[model samples]
Target: MLQMNDKKLYNDWAAKTSDSVMKRRPEINTKWEYEDGVVLQGMELVFNKTGDKKYLEYMMKSMDLFVDENGNIPKYSSNEFNIDHINNGKVLLALYEHTEDERYKKAADLLRSQLTNHPRTSEGAFWHKEIYPYQIWLDGLYMGSVFYARYIKEFGEEAEFEDVMKQFTLSYKHTRDEETGLLHHAWDEKREQPWCDKETGLSKHYWARSIGWYVMAIVDVLDYIPESYEGRDVLLNMLEETVEAMMNYQDKETGVWYQIVNQQERKGNYLESSGSAMMLYAIAKGVRKNYLSQDWFEKAEHIYKGIIDEFILTTKDGLVNVNKICQVAGLGGKDKRDGSFAYYISEPIVTNDHKGVGPFILASAEMEMLYEERK
Candidate 1:
């Protein structure tokens, strides 16, 4: 029952976002970073939908800040071997394909080279970063795997599929709580990190955004993985199980999710925006691709409305903003994030963070498409 104005929601927000981001690109970050990729990637989708050259221009202009004409990323260091750094490669890949710019390809090549020596666990999962040794984080899967799959599709060998599959399978196997089917934020393979359980090697709590990142990774990576690939079914099964588990924990009243996913009754834990948007995008995309049943559409519709009502806002300037986003969360950093319920809920909830805005736009795009097709 979407009104005509409802159909324009996605485009309006996208247009406002593109302009807002462009105005602030200089201050967004100093180095080549992942948050830029998150927002630009959403803008890429908007570009695809509307054929707006300005969206593409904004993406290229933002990236040019880091990528020199010689194709070197000025501030990026491969030696860091940080999986988070690889997230931007998705946008680079898009730029290379669309504009056939060699600089973009060479920049992407630089990121690809990092995985050549990126630290991995004994079972072959990429460590979250060189600093966090022997650890696999759910967030790393999205940062690394999506670009890895896309790179393999464009310029890699058939043998690379094994490496890609291991990232998803190994991360899921190690961190997933079998009973609940929800993954903890991270796992310390050596069980040495203070944040992890000494015996189980798993973190203490189920963080909604971490699980959200994991599910979003699965659906996005599936794009470049061929249907006939042997591991595709495994990824699909994992997606279904994780999404179903997420549904079981969704706030029935708000139709969103809590910061500490399973501890809904816990005091101070509130509904979160970024994670909810991530879930909406994954479920709606799954149904659109026919990987999920048609019956799931109603649920996707519900989530879309819920995200709109619970988190969206309008500025006095007539632009949109996403609020109530957990600014950041992680396990076992210098501050020793213990992955407890308090740790997840204590992060500053901010407005219009890229983590929330990008996913909200992506979700809106999916809902827009679904509405278009139904008409």
Candidate 2:
């Protein structure tokens, strides 16, 4: 249990942890990538909730490193048409809204341009990457769709929003397992990948973080969708359905989800941090937005506590750490990812990966808002 003083500090944990993430990187030395977007997204939430300029400043400084005077990202290449590249557009859009800077606008436009030509499956889901052709990964939903929806809401035609909805609905159609009610990590439409089931084109296991990415994408994208839009309910229904499936697999004793979500009885399976954090974040935001019932929030409260007890760590020097984050996972690359149960567990588990910390902070922000409302 958190100490009494620490309990009071829960309200500020988002900002504090976000700051910790900022201090660790503190520069634009890294490539413009999804990991940075994840952390910046958490910072964006904290800035929204707390009205803190420092948080905003940190965001600006970090982004300014890559987005220059002419709005060029030195390291980015649009020809790649990678869906993960779109993730950073969320921050670019947020930065533009706050500052009304043309550079940010131009940078955002460049990312949006990618979607116009990004390679896709015959059914129109964005391929996870240029290299992984004909593949749609659950991770890509959050990477690409959230930014797509937000971009359309900000600057694109109303009709363009249809493309945003297709990413979710189509991916769900392809990757969803009817028997388990869980989504597989990736779907290869041609079933050409060695990892994919030849007939189904689906990966073998239900990876928790991939589903976490999908769920968080659904809830976050719903923010930009108008209530009058028909697709809004489609997304809401998906959120409810996915959350229900997630809850069924959550370890009753630990209140955290396993890395291979549906395989709790498997010996090597363990509760993972990023996936667990992402799940709690989705549930909290879904409930706060009234897209889900309050009963879900009550259930999420237990899961949130479990996240703290299980993944969050404290140092003697007082820095907070997020442990047990899977360093990286993917399918069908030079690494030859097979996407089996063993492959999922074989990924390195490490501390303070942005994937885990970012969602943990985002989840904290939502929980804090709900707590304040009750008080």
Candidate 3:
């Protein structure tokens, strides 16, 4: 039986998260290109829960700082055409639908414009980035497909649906391991990157958050993709495969996933917050959507409980802090990330990190909804 303390814990954490965002305007600095998208996702979740006009206003104001009267995003570059950059389009679409803002529409169209010119492999997958040539990270699927689904829904683009299908089909064909039902972190189409596996085009290791992004992408995009489309079944299968593979790696003791998901026996590898939250969101939503059996909901609930108990912290001033979020993981680079167990653990962990926060809010939202429904 749940105690009063458990309820208080949830309420207190939610309130602190809301207060923290409300108290400060997220910085408009140029440190990283995706900062606005991350902040907007957080604000969107907050607004959804609180119905606070200020949260919406905050998101619009920050977006307006970069997007001009003509809808040009100040720091965005079409030449690069990286899929990660497309995430902000979701926020632009939201603002456009809610407010009928022309600037937001224009900004979204600018992102769409990149899709038109971006390079694709022969099988039609968008290369993860121009610099990374022939590589498609599981991370890129979420970054790009969510926006792809949104654009197809908003603009009535039937052709885009085919492209969306192709992206996932190509990704699964290249990255999925038949034996384990798990996806590799990336597939290097060129097979030249040192981390690339010569025969499979897969990277040397799997990273939890990378697959988490892919899982979240499929579930979220499925919401927008037309059910009648033949490709929808392929996506559903892919999502099932992802959940099945992920379930195998869940830590039996903690109900969370390892940073290097399959590396359970590796010394010092620990349960990670962002990936755990992503899996919880995936499983809960998968059950909610009937893509998976209701039994998965039990797994989702168990993991969410574990996350709150294990990763969540209350700061001295009452801020809800999510600890032990691995900073970032990736394949070959000048930095020599070997995609090994040691490399995964070497990444720094931080408190209340946005990577964990957005996913945690998403997981909490789904869990709260499920709990309310069961009650």
Candidate 4:
């Protein structure tokens, strides 16, 4: 599989860390940046694997930078209820489990508080943003649902499970294409957005990373969703359908998914890292949970190997590099993102990017666990 030496690769990946958690800020300090959560998620796995407490301490200290002794997060507003903001809840949950810290619990509760007041459509789908009215994005599902499911499980909030189910079902109902079984990037309920189709609630075309987010969310949330819940089977079926649909678009040569999943022939549409890692995680976990056949696991293993060989770079400094990460994807906005093949390819690709690195670390952790189980 990964020809690069394992010890050397580990050393390289570990070298990327900074000495103090408080010192880790984005090189280009932009709001809504992806760096902290990405590093924390990756570090969580690394710590679990190696039992190195420094990584865990780094995560706790970094989170402490945002959270105060009183358990309130600094510079965070719950009124916005943007699902992207909830991603860090995973770290909180981990901290609570490991350290039994009340501060982490309070910080997670703050995120849960947003769910009570967050705007939702009549069908129970969360709006992607307050400013972007009546829109449900594929990206939002992974962002919020994983945290929601974990919260519900941790606190015995069984009643909220229905809301979780409704979120996925409504999003799929609006965005799923009947013919291709692929989902659009976002759906505008008002159909007022220029990117939205008049007849269907769908955005332009199937975006690979968007679908990847949904796939990863479904599989992850299923872990905590009670097996007896009526809607649980529905989610499993959705995951199965999504897995089948995704397999059709995977490049046979590279064993990785493309930027625009269905449009491989179009110029500049290359294989992407985040989506590939997400798909690998979903498929491997699906098979582990017995929701999918063993055949899918073989495919996931193949793709995982492909990612290591093609996308990952081992720098001289011994840090792992995730190359060819699409910076961002979106629908209607001030900028024109038509969701065309060319538009998808036009996004800048960066090395050692956090977007891809977090998911890659997660996928690798799962694969390593599976290998251990088999052994």
Candidate 5:
């Protein structure tokens, strides 16, 4: 039941993601970075839905290259206090379930162990990373909490549920902007970071991708949260409110959101593919999981169509490319990123970046499944 465009774009991108790793892209191997985590996870989505052995084989081979016989993940130092590293741990659970290799379990355990000691704000939110002390980036919520929630569920560590939910609840409480109903990119508990608003302690504007990360985190984490858990309501409600806010800003003509979400009319602001893809995935998955209204079905369709019609271009060789992807976006990195509206729009836009391609694949998988269900 996959749409024609879904089959074309996702199939092309799936091959591209695996081919990139098979070639050992510099950023991809053994490193615990979430950017690669998402791509691997997206490959799993395709494998799960289509029963494609190659997709799963590619994912497993990539992990096997990095995770060793003793379940040790090379180049991953637990001392970094980086929640980004937690994202790859998501692949471990599925690998263990499929192969029942205790090494996968032990590998997952190592990642779960990091959450035990990861630093947190006074309000109990995790700092995005060690270097980003006292700040909670929306990016970290997806990177950390989805793995944390899944591990606790899979391992029967029910006691950790409350702590896991607190991260989501507190993030919404701290970062939400009532006027826009959009959460800021990150929140600085100390309000001392160069990007913070002295009075509000929140980043200056809503970057589409950051909000995309927050929404994707909850939708993914919700897969493991018990329906009876009251905290599930909190996460669902946040998803609803935030998506409602974001839909108001959707480009009326294109159905995609701007890089700086609130500045839709700004001269430099352009519609971004990765964030649009993430938003589509979140909405489609939310509706599929019954976490959001059925009305979101139409919204998801529009966004998906927008990405296909606006972002994807077919190459001369028939390979499809996803364009307008933000090459990178972060704060307080090596060069010192100033989290500003201008800073966001200035990032390079490229074709078929993992950030865009992975989410596009996941979103397509969700939409395909939804279409099958409705049929």
Candidate 6:
């Protein structure tokens, strides 16, 4: 198989997504959401890499629709504490640093304000959302802590640093399953939710994307956590253990992960692209940051090649598709997610999904740099 050019693939994906959504540009989905944030963060990384103002323009355009001249995000309510909403906060510091606009800072501060009083477990972790009370989802760590760590880094909130680090520490302590070394999807302290295991307070099975979210969370959040911090190495070691555990479950043939990661033999289990891409990003970035070793980079190289062959494909119609992405999954909402292995594999698979594409873009951005340096 021909080698995939990381830069070209990422650029093409972004252009295709931008064109598809052009009809709604100035009026883009201004929800301040995870999906939009994921894609735009990819765009932001690309912009950072290429120094092309176009990517910046795209991000600002969408943000402008929601942010007034004064920088109040209209629909955002910190009161509810939905971690999904915090995903967009990742891009704010980049915008503020480049533009030095008070609005960006104000907007970021608005998001950060939520952390101060956000509801938490008695042990001091933010609830995934208000509605999902007394619960912590692996997904929530990426969505919330990455921004929290970054805000502390930017604005010099030294006192809050320990709290930010503690969240990751506590999450690691609670969710990790020693037998498999894979953390479960979510944990309910009360264990009242239908999905949580009554004894362990952990969710039923290891959902790959939650692990993916978590791996990415630790790496990205580490960028803001000072290396000298007393607890940093503890988290770093935990990160290594988690990544190694996850790699052990990778399908030997497909090089991708399963929707229900641990049980490869289970019926309806299948290779999933988005989580695969996310793992690729986390591994590549972690290696790049020296949190992991040279061997891990080699491992990332192998996984990236696997992702290309398994998930990156050009359709007969000429659209390049990132295939096999699990569409959506959650626990205990209007339509209750039972958190079963079946519930995981049953989520509709999609192609070129923004969630998949976003991290793929970031992974590619890192790999592309590695590629260029090798040349």
Best by TM-score: 2
Quantify all predictions' global Cα lDDT against the true fold: 0.87, 0.88, 0.79, 0.78, 0.83, 0.80
Cα error, candidate 2, residue 122 (Å)? 0.7
- Per-residue accuracy of model 3 over 134-160 as CA lDDT, tens digit each: 888888988888888888988967777
Whole-model lDDT for model 6 versus the true structure? 0.80
Q: Tens-digit lDDT track for model 1 on 1-375? A: 433245444455555666666665644567787877888888888899889898898888888888999999989999988999999999999999999999999999999999988999998899999999999999999999999999999999867988999999998888889899889889999999988899989999888888988988988988999888999999999999999999999998778999999989999998899999999889988988877887888888777777878888777876677889999998877998877778787889998889988888788777777767876
Model 4, residue 218: distance off in Å is 0.9
The prediction achieving the highest lDDT against the true structure is 2
Q: How are the candidates ranked when ordered by TM-score, highest leading? A: 2, 1, 3, 5, 6, 4
- Relative to the unseen true structure, what is the C-alpha lDDT of residue 80 in candidate 4, on a scale of 0 to 100? 73
At residue 45, give the lDDT of candidate 5: 82
Quote model 2's TM-score: 0.97
* Per-residue alpha-carbon lDDT of candidate 4 for residues 1-375, written as tens digits (9 for 90 to 100): 334344432332332432222233423233434445755776787688778897788778777778789889876788876778887888888899989999999999998888778888877788887876789999888888888899999995788899899899999999899999999999988888877787776787787789988998898899889888889889999999998998899999778989888989887788898889888878877877787887676687678777877797756664466788898888767795676666778889876566787777767766666655654
Q: Model 6 reaches what TM-score against the true structure?
A: 0.92
Which residue segments of model 4 deviate by more than 4 Å?
1-35
Which digits, one per residue and each the tens of the lDDT, describe model 6 over residues 64-97?
Answer: 7767799898888888878788888877777888
Off by over 4 Å in 5: 1-30
Q: What is the lDDT of candidate 5?
A: 0.83
Q: In candidate 4, which residue pairs clash?
A: 12-318, 12-319
- Preferred candidate (TM-score higher): 1 or 5: 1
lDDT of model number 1: 0.87
